[model samples]
Target: MTVEGFDGRLDRYLSEVLSKTRSFVQKIIEEGNVWVNQTQVLKPAYKVRSGDIIRIVIPEPKQLSLVAQDIDIEVVYEDEHLAVINKPRGMVVHPGAGNFENTLVNALLHKFSGKLSSINGVIRPGIVHRLDKDTSGLLIVAKTDEAHIKLSEALKSHQIKRIYYAICEGVLKEDSGVVDAPIGRHPVNRLKMAVIPNGKQAVTYFEVLERYDKYTFVKLRLKTGRTHQIRVHMSYIGYPLLGDSTYGRSKNEFGIQGQVLHAGEIKFVHPITSDVLHFSTELPEYFLEILNILRSRNSKYHV
Candidate 1:
């Protein structure tokens, strides 16, 4: 690809233009897969000038060492190019570090077998985006590399719509508002994310759906998919999610394991057919039960 008006670091420019992550681009650059002005460039920090010609060679997918397990998964929709799954709470999206079994990837591997895309390598087979382990909702898996690239590009350009439902701890005064905050890894606690000045751009638009004395049910739409964007932003505004142990109160009356957040809906255009597709899933049974209890309590207070 030829550089246009960008005059920044090579890696950042390529990551923005190609819709690939910075880390992925850096890996290929280190492997000598990138060229600038017809010269092989190995450093990710190389500065680029306008009109400079650049080329990136994507390598073939490598063999991954993972076992397929017969785990149960809920498939919302599936076709030749992609599959949408309604992931349940408590299931990790993929294996990592200490978690090697009983993940959604294992279930996909068992069900699709050799039919998943390999762009994400062994561990994440067909994963295009991710949801936190405890946040249940819709997730898309690519059946082929072509679809994966298209979907990834769509996500980078904000063409894909992801809506979430969350039960926050406090009643928000506004009916609807946008949380425009940048998110980065927490400086003090490496395991957490926070709204820092130099963090990646993140925006979340939320609307109040129901309001109780001490809790508020809201719908959130993600404009940018930064890590833990909603959780961090909500906490920053003093309405942390009810059961979020990381960002909210440690003890919860609901007796839930994780945050009360759900990926409720996803909308995107079909990669090959160009047809618009939308999918949504209902809240989990436990979430609804808590809402009912809250409603009963609110009614008693009114009476």
Candidate 2:
């Protein structure tokens, strides 16, 4: 499709259209993989007008094997078409490079007995979306082709609302607001995501649920789910999540192992029956402990 009056910069446009994460898209641009109207445009922040046909070429990540390694998974909801699980912190959803063992897929294989859909190939049998290794939360897995297609459609249409709760490192100035910045890999640091010119369209909505002496409890709604979207957006606005070393903060006070965030809730329609399905999980023990510590410093806080 041709470009429109979308005021976002070039990277944002390409990212939104390609549906890939900002970091992946940015790599493509930097490698001379993006062209607007057949002309290569490498600037990440170049603005564009309507009807400007843009092309982005994204290279596939190195292929990895899906090996079964007997990791335990907390199953929350399961049906013929999908399975929702409380993916605990430290569990990798699928097997990838450098991590072929001790992943959720291996556990799924042991539990489901090869029943998950093979559409995602042997490596990621039923994965649609993904959570970072450190982010614990609810995740949905598809079992059949029909179910997978339906769930995919729902996610793309934004009908599947994924909400997260996080404890950011600082107090937020606004009670509620949207982070509508384009995000991509850091130009200098390939490991981190940043608000760069040739970044992808990323939007995150957050509301302050409570405030502490040095932290804020925030509820986040993702308009788009990119790799590290919430973390990057929060860091871009100067309120990185506690223990999220990749984004901005160098450390966490609560002694947590990873980022202090959780996929608190998810709402979607049943792929088979079309019934509305909603599931929520309480914060993990460590998450609550951190919040308690922060709130304890401020006696006005409530659980």
Candidate 3:
């Protein structure tokens, strides 16, 4: 909520506006659940400005334990320090909020057990990065804490390379271009991201691979990793990815279940050995089939 004309202490304002007790507002604030302009405020007497945006995240009850199910995950590569996985589409990476069981973390826990890193706590053990639930492709997991730290540093410095392939909703005329937009949470919808002026820097470089009459096959690379960067940027440019219901059409012509995007390639330096590493994978059977269907329509349309 953005404060307007209210210039007073946070607790008093929250208590009156939310109809909660004074002690309750103070308790949540002291627990670090309240934020003023994206910074957590532990002080109840923190003064508020008229334009300050306040947010509060009430955490859910913690799960007792994570279940290690016998879920099959394709381990593309592995070493003492790290592992690469070809994560399938429709699989949640980690369990949280309305999702408790049957996640990649559970599958990895079942397979790797004590070998995975614990830097991200029990809920997200070994997870150094993530792909959306509907997106498929390669992912890297850390085996040791030292490896995790180094990999995280590399990612923060934009040294890690991530490449993607997608079938978008429209034919892009440009052969290659970049979408450099600032991305932040939607003003109205908290669940979605949008291109906003006061958002984080998000850059996506795309090259046209095949242009069909109705859609375009494109390869993309990320310069900066923000949540839903590619999907949001593409949609902002008026060519949302096929099957991206959140930012684009809910129902597409192909009837694909999720967004037609895949992390097909990744490159990074080995943490322990200091060796450069690169990995790539073919498009999934379903994505390839869709491309073939578009290709068979006409060779002239594809430039």
lDDT of candidate 3 over 1-303, digit per residue (tens): 998889989998987677544555787899999999999999999999799999987556344288888999999999989999999999999999879798999898888875787667678888999999999999999998779878887897899999999999988989999999999999999999999999998899999999998899999999999999989999999899999999899898788877999999999999889999999998999999999899889667565
lDDT of 3: 0.89
Q: Score residue 28 of candidate 2 by CA lDDT.
A: 72
Give the winner by lDDT: 2 or 3. Answer: 3
lDDT of 3 at 153: 75
Minimum summed lDDT over a 10-residue window in model 3 is located at 56-65
Q: Per-prediction TM-score, please?
A: 0.87, 0.77, 0.80
Give the Å error, residue 286, model 2: 0.4
- Which portions of model 1 show Cα errors greater than 4 Å? 1-25, 33-40, 45-60, 300-303
Ranked by lDDT from best down, the candidates are 1, 3, 2
Which candidate tops lDDT? 1
- lDDT by residue (1-303, candidate 2, tens digit) is 589768778777766776544544666787898888889888788778888887766666444345555667888888777899899898888988787788888888777776776546568887878899999999998888568666776777788999999998888979999999998888998977888888888989999999887788999999888789999999889999989888856766556667888999999989899799899999999888777777678889633
Clashing pairs in 2: 3-51, 4-50, 11-198, 11-199, 44-197, 44-198, 45-197
Best by TM-score: 1
Comparing 1 with 3 on TM-score, the higher-scoring candidate is 1
